[model samples]
Target: MDERFTIRAMKKEDIEEVYEIEKMSFTAPWSKESLYYELEQNLFAKYLVVEYEGSVIGYCGLWVIMDDAQITNIAVHPDFRGRKIGEALLRFSMQLCKEMSAKRLSLEVRVSNHIAQSLYRKLGFETGGIRKNYYTDNYEDAKVMWVNLG
Candidate 1:
């Protein structure tokens, strides 16, 4: 990671920029209200933002309950793709889950998103199952992947 890049807990003020990244990266982007609820009302949710040159460039959302943690969302600004920022963010999330005593980490990715699946596999995640018609936008199937943190 470059000195100019830093990852920290997402603040309420970051919702706007983080939402922009979400819109650019996903077909069904999460609303600002949903983001707000995640930060303010969701007891199990933890969100993190990655900043570059003092600008928000990416964010990741995790939900840890008991011994399990799920990556609720993750995205990088389109302009920052291919720079390994997403990888760094995911690695940090995994460490955070471990610190929270989560024994496993999981996420669902669009089955067609080979790039993301490759990255998850590189981080030791394996395909667990598939959810048919999981995506509302195009009715795409979702590939569930998980890795044990223990």
Candidate 2:
């Protein structure tokens, strides 16, 4: 971990950096408009960004619904991969979910993303189900994963 890096709640000013990371991390990244809407209008949405010496390097978003927290997205900058930033982001999100009184945390990852699936498994996420053709851009299947906090 870089001593200069810190994790904190995402701000409206971080949209550009977040967008850049999203573009680098995912084939079909969320639009800036969607990110803006989450920051401005979504009460259930909670986002966190990792800043390395004041620059946003990674970000993750979660949506709290009832007693569950759904991990909407998570991405690390291409330059910062293999540095454990993603794990830190996931840990922070899990802590936030617990603090928000969520009994479980859930997310959907592309079936082809074995690396992410391995990471989630190491973090205690278990496969719940599969969504056929969940990702439209490439028609990739999605594997649903869940972690019980209770």
Off by over 4 Å in 1: none
lDDT of each: 0.97, 0.94
Using TM-score as the measure, the top candidate is 1
Taking every candidate in turn, the Cα RMSD to the unseen true structure, in Å, is 0.5, 0.8
Can you write out model 2's per-residue Cα lDDT over 1-98, one digit (the tens) per residue? 66788999999999999999898888899999999999889999999999998899999999998899999999999899998999988998999999
**Considering summed lDDT, which 10 consecutive residues are worst modelled in model 2?**
1-10
Write candidate 1's Cα lDDT for 4-78 as tens digits: 999999999999999999999999999999999999999999999999988999999999999999999999999
Number of backbone-clashing residue pairs for each candidate, in the order shown = 0, 0
